[model samples]
Target: MKSNYFFRSIHAMRGLASFAVLISHSLTLYPFFEFRAAAAGVDIFFVISGIVMCLAIEEDTSKLDFIKKRIIRVVPLYWIATGLSVAYIYARYPHMSHSWDWIIRSFLFLPQQPGVDMPILYTGWSLNYEMFFYLILFLSLFIFKNAPIAAACIVAMIASFSAVGNLISYNYFFKQIFIEFSLGILIGYFLKFGGRVEKNLGIFLIFLALVIFFIHNKFASSGFLAWGVPSAMLILGAISFENSELFKRNFVKIFGDASYSLYLVHPLVIWGIEWYVLPEHRGILQVAIAIAISIFISIIFYKWVEKPLMRFLSKNL
Candidate 1:
């Protein structure tokens, strides 16, 4: 398949967001900076997921086929990661005791039961949200037959959920974060409607404003504006604007290709650094070591696991 500049840019941004999450998690070790930038990275993924899914599914496809493709794409890698985490926990803390309940929950992608500590694969929680988004998208396939109607519905739902989330408890309202997915879908719809326009400077400025707003608020309303809106704009702008030759270089393409593996594996690397490598270390040294380890692990995982699995999946599925 010929790679488009739009998709390529999205991939690059995904890699950047994944690395940002790794850095954010690393910063948690220091006393000076407690901010978590990693969580914002998940929001970025959510938006991209929505946009990509809409674009991918624009052609007629059965819900079963769509779901099957999703499962093939997501489940295998996820299960492998979860299994590795379980094995690590068991080996390292054999005396601590094991709860089959948590294992089962994690395998099924269910929410962790109250008072049950999540497995070493705590990052898997986001996959639950991803699965939820897929279900919603699958069910709405018929209702969203008309792209404009679908886009309108998505926007309305996001607005409603945002209002509800703000007015109510986070637990009750937090599901509204899925609105980012809808925002992505709307972006695809707009693109389909010939909405491409040259506005890289404007889009970049908006993205900067959103980032500043997010940093100021520490992502309190990021799901709505900082993440959802800006990500959509970025994708649109990237698609509309002409891409430079530099962006199409082999190194950038490789990073984009490895983005997913980087995202999936970085958390475990971060946990390892925090828990074992430099448990007592503090300051910039800790951050630097953690980042170094994360990058190394990300590269290995991408080369050994992600690329091979994607290739196999593409061929078999």
Candidate 2:
């Protein structure tokens, strides 16, 4: 392992995690099965964001540049998706006035509801956490030059804000999900400094993740634990195979590259099916169709919309 060595595992896991989130929502929409573990995909994503932000900062990107790139990466497609969500909302509920609080706040990445409820385009809530995390990291860049130290400071900052945020917004922004990001930051630190684990250890980590996932699902609480620890374990395991080209498939790479699109667009596709094509139908067929359609459309959106926009923007920047 080397500091600058790119990990295919990161890309591969993005694909997997995005699919898991898609499946989780699909399941939620259809009510076909009980697979709360799929929700851990959000944890997986948080960890990935942590690692990405860490690596970006460590590579000597300016604080302003870091935030700029992050905004460019996240904001464009999100706004498009939000616009679509607004249309979906109005179409669904013609009674809702145009000056709704949730609509405005969703664009600003504020909480759409009082406590723990997601925004329109439901999966967009995760982006709120992501934007805040980037802000924290951007601020940290002014103080701690060390990536790991800055990451640690981010954890503390999140904890501090979470403690105070509970009084007013009751937002998840200051909650246990940061643990996954911290875990990823620690992992990113280790890898950045040339850390590696044995294959057997990687396997063990995944096994342990499963155990923890089951235990958490069955008994453990949210906040401090929930899915954070296990998702970290799973990611740590995946990256262990980074040097082996295990995640190097073209198909896999596309999924990873297109993950953001997959995440934002799938909810629309799924609910669209529920609203028109598969209304009141509770079956796995709808789930399959939703996933397939989501993946297909996301790839197209990535290639045509997201990739081109980012390229043009980055080139100009």
Evaluate residue 32 in candidate 1 and report its C-alpha lDDT on the 0 to 100 scale: 62
* Model 2 agreement with the true structure over 14-70: per-residue lDDT tens digits: 999999988888876666656777788888898887777666665566778877888
Candidate 1 C-alpha lDDT tens digits along 1-317: 11331466677667766776777777776646645434577777877777677666754667677777788778888888888888777876889988888898898877676675454487778787787667666777766675434643654564576555346533422455667777777776665555665666647755765575457456455455655565555555555443656557787777677776766776666666666755465678878877787777777888898779877986887
Off by over 4 Å in 2: 1-3, 113-116, 160-172, 218-221, 277-279
Instruction: Compute each candidate's TM-score over C-alphas.
Output: 0.83, 0.91
Clashing residue pairs found in predicted model 1: none
State model 2's lDDT: 0.80
Please give the TM-score that candidate 1 achieves against the real structure: 0.83
Give the clash count for each candidate.
Answer: 0, 0
